[model samples]
Target: MPRISHPRSSSTPLHEGGELALIERIRRRAGGGASTALRLGIGDDCAILRPRAGEDLLVTTDFSLEGRHFRRDWHSPQSIGHRTLARGLSDLAAMGARPMAAFLSLALPPAVARDAGWLEGFLDGLLDLAKQHGVPLAGGDTSESPSEQVLADIILLGSAPRGRALRRSGARVGDLIYCTGTLGGATAEFAQVQDGRGGKTQTASSMNPHLFPQPRLAAGQALLRRKLATACIDTSDGISTDLAHLCEASGVNAEIDAASLPLHPLAQQLTQEAAMAAALHGGEDYELLFTARAATKMPRKLGGVPLTCIGRVVAKKRRAPQVTLIAADGSRSALAAQGWEHLR
Candidate 1:
């Protein structure tokens, strides 16, 4: 029987079709290798791995889908490609691992595949990021799709010293919560870029934060090396939501001083209260949120990135798993978890 060209329509809600089948087909094409070290590749019950002695493996995966995660019309193919890889690499950096290799799986609309330059540019962007971090692309698959959306999934593998991986569950009471770089600037930029009101200056600076978010690899690694962080997580899900994750994992609550948040200059200029709200709730910042002992005198900056003491982890109270924001006037309010939620 001839293979069906496309998956069932989205409205049909069928189990099969579109990108899912394409991924399976690609896995079947890459036959298994005979080496024991070739632990996990395509088509497996679970990815098996044999870690080298004295090393702990770090693994992370991220997916980018057009419209849902990004828009092809607004972003160039190169930017999309770069952001996809950066998102996954940032996860590895959060663990303070040295990047080793990456694997990408792409689902391309027929239109995009036909444009040779478009694909080349996208690959160029991905390759450029890989070279900058010394992580090479090991393998991936490509396929055609009926939808105009372009979807990319990246898997990154790295390694760290044995038994030294940083985690979000390690935070303790009285630990100071800190974050790198400025906040809310990316969301403000997104608003302007989407509205077309972002002039050259806003377009250049504001939107760039959202478009090309830098992973805090160096700072994360340094924190790990210095044993300064008891807990860590990448701030892809806004400061409020991400901090909440750490608190939840550590069975603690958090209090963030609203006045203490380090707002990006662009965010201050382009947005005011609402923008600050978005910065607290908006996702995709890709910065690092971490905790250290209250006595730890963290530098004002890490790897030239400004470090802000935003709040502290506290014992779980009756209303546990809550994040509270303290105003400058000493008034206390609930910090809403308004970050990205797919189902919402």
Candidate 2:
């Protein structure tokens, strides 16, 4: 079990400020106006959202639980807060949507709530990301947890042109597969952090993929504007598992080139077998995995992130595996959905 500690000290307990005060603190820090899509926010029973005319609204929700999603000992409050919002934002990104507003419901344990430092860090991380994407923290609920764990749930709302949002089921046989950014950095960084080899500083510029994975929102939007992707999904559950989801949704198969896999520099530091496993199954990379028509002339990068053609979609063969990995020496093997599956 990880011990929880607050970096900064405060004489006032969270209860002294009360729940309403907490909400007010968040509302004051949430600073808005960048997104005109959110007409009214943060003090109302319901937030008013005005999606651009002819655009469709997209909503995604994710839960971040202590022990399951993060550890108080291992992850900083800021990282915890960032990952909470990032999870929901990445979903919006995968669908090629522009985030408009966010709702956060938090359950804090006494240990976390008692100290103002933790909440400050958490809000700092979450609001910083929200500002970067121009998404307003419109509304939410806060409560004391019955148990000793912190729980956070974020609901993100986004918008996209009507009939233009990407879908995983749009992939067709022969569409080339591509992914934004490199792979396995999250898993590699997690291992290093767990083993006490990771960095102590937590800055946005730091190369801590596990702690602060960047959601590929811009890349997803670029694909939408250019109409380049036939299908898309964010790599939140790792490529192996998420690709299986895409294949199942599209009723197609995929063949990935093992040698062509874009391994993250951190992943390369591991042994060959470990690196390969991490590349295949490391979850929470938050990169976008997409398919485009084979004839499309894809640029070298999208939204400032490099694009790599890792594979191509294929017609599903009867009784054959849905995904296959072709090794450097002409060997082929079935690729299983081995990444982050809950309740297994």
Candidate 3:
């Protein structure tokens, strides 16, 4: 079992009127109005979606748990809501899909259940992001948790053009590896939050990447449209582990150069070991990692986000390992799959 932790007894209480009343409040806050595709949305037994013509449906679900994913002291209700939904959306982005709708199921703690303001703030964060992405909150379930922690599950539905969804199996030998955005910010954020240095390190300008990650939806869409990537995945788990998954799927090996990693500036402020460790093993970056042909020309930026080439995919010889890490001095070693993992 995961370790248990409690939120400080400080925020608004959830509505005592219970589940049905909570549902209505969330429905209103979600702005689930009738649309042609959604003939029946929140009020229905199940949401009905009239799929877009010639598109493939993509569905992904993600969960956010209290002690496992966040602490109420470290995260605001609004940030928590935004992040939970964002986690599901990031999965869709990996497949180059456009968001269509979302379903949210919440198991709220008693303290939060009795707090109307807390609920409102949470819904506002979730709904606002949904609106921004043109994904309406279609339908969901709600209940008070039997314990002190809150648990949330988000199911996001998206669509991509027929036969165009990106996967981790298409990369081939000699393809160049690419990643969007800097690495290490989320790692730094995690250290500050979990090590009890959050108050000392965090500021309005220096936001935690773990708390506020921008999924690479636009970059994924652009890559799909331009047919630029042979394989794609998001950098949710640390790059070393996630890239290992991609390499295994594609039946290839990878060589990542330590010097080529595009690290967050904050990485420079840390010890050399910490920076490199975070760059390799820290998770929750939520950026894009893709493989493209070596000769294929790529734009310097996608959707105003820099796209940097960091490594290359190679055909694995018999008994060869999946990934190799190249040090700054060009020495090579078998890459360790030591990134973040659940229950680790």
lDDT of 1 at 159: 80
Candidate with the greatest TM-score versus the true structure = 2
> Mind giving the per-residue lDDT tens digits that candidate 2 earns over 275-323?
8888889888899999999999999999999999999999999977889
What TM-score would you give candidate 3 relative to the actual structure? 0.90
C-alpha local distance difference test of each model: 0.73, 0.86, 0.80
Q: Name the TM-score of candidate 1.
A: 0.82
Worst 10 residues of 2 by lDDT: 1-10
Rank order (by TM-score, best first): 2, 3, 1
TM-scores for the candidates: 0.82, 0.94, 0.90
Which structure is stronger by lDDT: 2 or 3?
Answer: 2
Model 1 segments more than 4 A misplaced: 1-52, 197-207, 342-344
lDDT per residue for candidate 1 within 5-53, as digits (tens), equals 2444434311234444544543443332233334555443334546568
